[model samples]
Target: MAISNVLMFGMVDFSGLLDKFGIDWHLLLIQSLNFVLVAFLLYRFGFRSVARVMDERREKIELGLKYADDMKREKAAFESSRAQRAESARREAEGIVKSAKDGAKAILEQGKMELQQQSAGMILNAEKEIARRRKKILGDAKAEIGTLVVEVAKSVLASQMTDRDRNNYAAMAEKMLP
Candidate 1:
């Protein structure tokens, strides 16, 4: 009977409590609806679009970073290969020089001034030819490497760039190239 009396008498009544705090139910309902509408509008019209744009920019930046890393790997590989080729060329050039000197010594053993002079001329001509071939090889390798670098840059830029980025990178690459 005590529980029933308490429940029946107004145990949950807020009327007097709300009145003491100057809270009006009608105004509270209106403000709650207003808050919901404003939140929905902000999310729909402002935050959603901004979030999408941020996501797009984030993706582009990530792709650019990945392309830069690939470029570093490719450049390292190119450098290693170029070094190997240069070392090989140097060793070959040294061997040719050594062989020419040996032949010149053999011809000098004949003890004729004319043969010695002719052998000296032959040795000098061989040295000149060796230098010419080495220079040509180095020039060809450099031209090939430069072409490969430009092609790689073009491919990377095509994949990673906006038009503005493409133009900027093209300008930069041109500046880097002779």
Candidate 2:
């Protein structure tokens, strides 16, 4: 029986409750129309415009970030290239300097060797000149001594010899001479 009453209650209509609660359909309909109008106006005039501005700002920020990133990469690459070129120049300069130093050293060594050779040649020439002068002086001295000895011998023989014996001595001396 209780189950039968529960089923009966489920079937009962509750329109009388609204009347008791002082509800008005005309007022409800008007409030509903006002809410729908406010929502439509906010979406059309407020939310859509705010969303559009926010989207523009977001796109600008993204583009700016991309441009900044590209600039940073370019700067880094330029710096690296500059550094590499500088290093290459430094190495080339060092090589040029080293080669110049080596060339100077070789020239100096060659100059020294040439000077030594010239000095040796000069010394040899001086020695040869001295030997030639010595030989000439000795020859002249020998000739002078021979002439003096012959004169002294002639003076001694003139004082000692009679004319008769001197003629015979003269013949012997002449035969002994060149």
Task: Quantify all predictions' global Cα lDDT against the true fold.
Answer: 0.81, 0.80
Model 1 per-residue lDDT tens digits across residues 1-178 = 9988777566445556677788988999999999999999999999999999999999999999999999999999999999999999999999999999988887777657777788999999999999999888767866665566556776865566566665565567546655
Record all residue pairs in model 1 with backbone atoms less than 3 Å apart, i.e. clashing. none
Candidate 2, 116-170: lDDT as tens digits: 9999999999999899888777667655554554555568775675665655555
In candidate 2, list every pair of residues with a backbone clash: none
Candidate 2 regions exceeding 4 Å error are 1-13, 20-23, 117-178
- Compute the lDDT for candidate 1: 0.81
- Candidate 1, 163: how far from true, in Å? 99
- Sum up the clashes in candidate 2: 0
Number of backbone clashes in candidate 1: 0
Q: Candidate 2 deviates by what RMSD?
A: 7.9
